[model samples]
Target: MSDTTQMETGRFALNSLKMLLVVGILTLVANSIGPETGFRAGFVESIPGMGLIVLIGLVALLLGRAIPLDLPAFAYAMIIAFALALPFSPVQGPFLGYVERVDFLATTTPILAYAGLSIGLQTGRMKEVSWKLVVVAVFVFFGTYFGSALIAQAVLSAQGLI
Candidate 1:
């Protein structure tokens, strides 16, 4: 590879690391001050869990870049995280305990905000798309939501939790 290309790659990796650290800090703050009283774990207490999450995300990003396929980093991250947290995995106990300390909603807030901002910035591109695409997106989102709710209800009922 050319020197310029290598330099750019190094810069990109550094930027990604910085972004992941910022996200970890944001998630820690959000988790510490979330609306739910039960989720008020102090910021200091949540550092290890959040750091682990960021490290996993960084590993996933690197893996995605190393692999030739077009799959996104989050996909690889999910697979890796799931493997580590599986019941039979050697790291399952500590992994789950630390991860569970990080509230799910806290992690999603920044991601959703980023998604919204990106979509907002692309409104002109979105307008260029056929209206049918919007309709399809709505239906897909609705179907996903309904399916998730149904599955949640069934699971809760089975467990006598609802």
Candidate 2:
């Protein structure tokens, strides 16, 4: 590979490593707060389950790092993980139930928190926005929000979940 290609590969691997760290920490925290028993022996018991998830995710990330891929490391990792998680896949027996928890939102909280902070960190750049631009941005945001909600509602209604 050229110097530029090497640098790009390193950057991708670094980003994937950071993602693994954040996601692993979040997954551990979510598991520690058991769906049934807040945080007692249940948390300790759930360690292996959460660890397994992070472990597989790490393996995927490493696999992506070892070979250049068109997709981002994490994206490729997720596809790899999904393949391993299919119902008929032998690997599914271990993580399927743990991942099925209704409160899986716990893991999402950290990701959302990171997103919010990332946007907030751009406050300096955002100051250059004109009022007109701001108004348009707000409208676009609302439009996307409403559009997604409407689409979700329609899908849920069709599935008798509404």
For model 1, what is the alpha-carbon lDDT of residue 15?
A: 85
Question: Model 1 over residues 24-46: C-alpha lDDT tens digits?
Answer: 99888888878765544678877
For candidate 1, the 10 contiguous residues with the lowest summed lDDT are 1-10
Cα lDDT over the full model 2: 0.67
1-162 per-residue lDDT for model 2 (tens digits):
224545465676677667776676676676556555433224445556566666667667666656655455568657766887898898787666554442465667777878998998798888798899999989999999999999999999999997
| CA lDDT of each prediction against the hidden true structure | 0.84, 0.67
Which pairs clash in the backbone of model 1? none
Model 2 TM-score, all chains together: 0.61
In model 2, the runs with Cα more than 4 Å from the true position are 1-23, 34-41, 63-70, 98-103, 145-162
Error of 1 at 2 (Å): 15
Q: TM-score, each model?
A: 0.73, 0.61
Stretches of model 1 off by over 4 angstroms after superposition: 1-9, 37-40, 129-162
